[model samples]
Target: MRLTRRRLCSSAIALYCLFSLYAAYHVFFGRRRQAPATVVRGLRKGAAAARDRHGQAEQPPLEMEEWNPWEGDEKNEQQQRIKNRLQILNKSTKGKTHISVQIWSKAAIGLYLWEHIFEGLLDPTDVTAQWREGKSVVGRTHYSFITGPAVLPGYFTVDVNNVVLVLNGREKAKIFYATQWLLYVQNLVQIKKLEHLAVVLLGNEYCNNEWINPYLKRNGGFVELLFLVYDSPWVNDVDVFQWPLGVATYRNFPVVEVSWSLLHDERPYLCNFLGTVYENSSRQALMDILKQDGHDKLCWVSAREQWQPQETNESLRSYQEALLRSDLTLCPAGMNTECYRIYEACSSGSVPVVEDVMTTGSCGNTSVPRPTPLRLLKAMGAPFIFIQNWEELPAVLEKEKTLILQEKIERRKILLQWYQHFKSELKMKFTNIIESSFLTTNKP
Candidate 1:
């Protein structure tokens, strides 16, 4: 009986010890397991309460790993700056103004200005495209482009207050059309039909623009601003701004998209010159020099006796292909040093070996030390090889031979980048100037 009682006491003691260990395990470890869930429930409740108090949903917590990798990238920074500037522009000029781009010239220079500067901001249309009435936030100021007088009726219905008349005053007959357009617009302004007027004039190659003075605001006329082409001495950045003679859009020279091949591809020809070679001109001399050095064989040279105003598709394609396949474009002075070829070469990442001598024109004063021939290009620091005489062409070509593929690629990249920057900077400046002058208050 005593032995049986001893065994029962020992079993009872073991059971008590086991129960204590189980209770301790639950107190220490099991509570830790439940604490996370309890804390999570409490946090969710707190978030809900905060939202209720504020009458808005709680913002999501930022992820620990989320960050912009391109924070230091120059291209990204430029894009951001442009985006910010655009935002400012949009916000400031919301609905205070309405403008129209009236392209009066069929000239490539006119098309170049319209396509590069205003086309992106305005509704895309040609000389024949009909106008529509609507609004969007894509551009700060609303603009409409028309090529002919047929679309004037649409502007009348929309009550467009501001007008940018793009005219080609390059020749005597062209100047007549420009004046007529001015008179028509002046009549509208006199009738209080239009609020503001600006002119984008492709001035004569020689820079004789005295005829348009009577229609300027300074002379008690309506036109407030003038964006003139060529190296006009009158580009004071106030009333008149120097506009670039961009690529020949009339010849269907496209906005060449920068590609790997355009920058790095092995071009066959060392240089190219495909245009009308005038008799006893610098171009004639250039042709002679090229042949004398037997560089004509290495370069793509195509010269015609008469200058054609218009280009055929086949001819234009061939010209563009030459620009693309050649490393350098030989830009001899035509009527002016600044030609469509210079800008076109830039589009193809081809360097322009320009004949930089000032032509006999009223463009600038020889008395003053101002850069006459290509003043705007010089000011903007165009990466072009400028020579006073065609005799320097042989030396330039000889130097070009020493540059390897990698060096050429780097140069092409710089040229393309610079050209794009120039266009964008001009676009922004043009927009800002218009807004400042036309709008009574930028804040809307």
Candidate 2:
């Protein structure tokens, strides 16, 4: 019995030693491998739970919050850089005189004056004048544009060292308000407080001199420069700015860089007239003459009883193409003898056949120059056919039919070259005049 009991005790002690060794290995090496597997399993389970709740696997959240701890500092540094750049530009142009442009935004002419006319003349730093009531200063020049009459009164107290007043002469409201504004500016001029004042007066009434002439005659000396749309001998102090080409109509259209090769293609029509037809108007007379002579078959004539304010994209394109393809563009006088069509046709290398009769309007001094219609075109050396009556259309067509392709091409080149030179010369004169009169002057 003693021997059997001792054998059993030895066997139990060996089993206990084996179990301790296995536990020691598992606590150290085994657990290290199992820990990674356990973590992976947990991640899978979490992702599955997320999918069940959201119907999609969720991405692990990013540490963006940790990365952007210095956000405010970064923004401040960027703003400081912009301020420093503007300050440097301002410092460089410190001695340059500033100009303030006060204009109504709705006026299409105002856009032309600011964008096309003044773009090359003034830098952003050159327009540092401020208005009490205006939208944020435009560009780097800090030009305060007070748009409407409601805020115009606020400009009464504002400084007008060098100012441009843009007025649409056609609108009744603009005329009324402009009269009031001019009266105020006239008072300042009387005291010699306002030295450099320029006016860009647009939309002159066809024959009526009463609206513009009286104001201009009274305030002529007060105004240093006058940019008039339709020049009149009655208003001899005015400087003529020709009716700009389809810029106001199709604002984005490139009227300057027309494809000469495309324009040189064989044209199907001798002339084109795309405009409104009014009763007793010269356009009606032109239609009558065209119909009688069967010239409608030889020309591209599209006329409507009423005038349209805007054209569709397709119609605008068609009109431009017509101008490009036609040999001549008929420009019958509307409210004035000089219309935008004359300039637009010139851009397309289409000779303008203008009706040179002075429409029943008070444009020029009747006594001195006999108010020759289209005097502006004649003065500009425009290569156009001027006719006193629509009866002369058949004779003009006869002459056109005799011209050969090479002759037509030569004419187109000459017209295109002249048009370009005209614009360049005008720009040079405009810049020189402004600099000499307003910017370079030492007057306070």
Candidate whose TM-score is highest: 1
Whole-model lDDT values for every prediction: 0.78, 0.66
Candidate 1 clash pair list: none
TM-score of each: 0.75, 0.62
Q: Which lDDT tens digits does candidate 2 get at residues 1-444?
A: 999999999999999999999998876567544334444565677779899999988764343112333657998999999999999999998876555444433344554444443432222321222321342233223344443223454354555555667666666776786677677777776787666666767656463435655455345546566666664544453343443322442233333565758547777789999889999888999999999979988999999999887777787887888888799999998887767788778878899999887766667567765567665557779888888898999999989999988889889988988877766665565545555666556465
| Candidate 1 Cα lDDT to native | 0.78
Error of 1 at 178 (Å): 1.5
Worst 10 residues of 1 by lDDT: 131-140
Model 1 TM-score, all chains together: 0.75
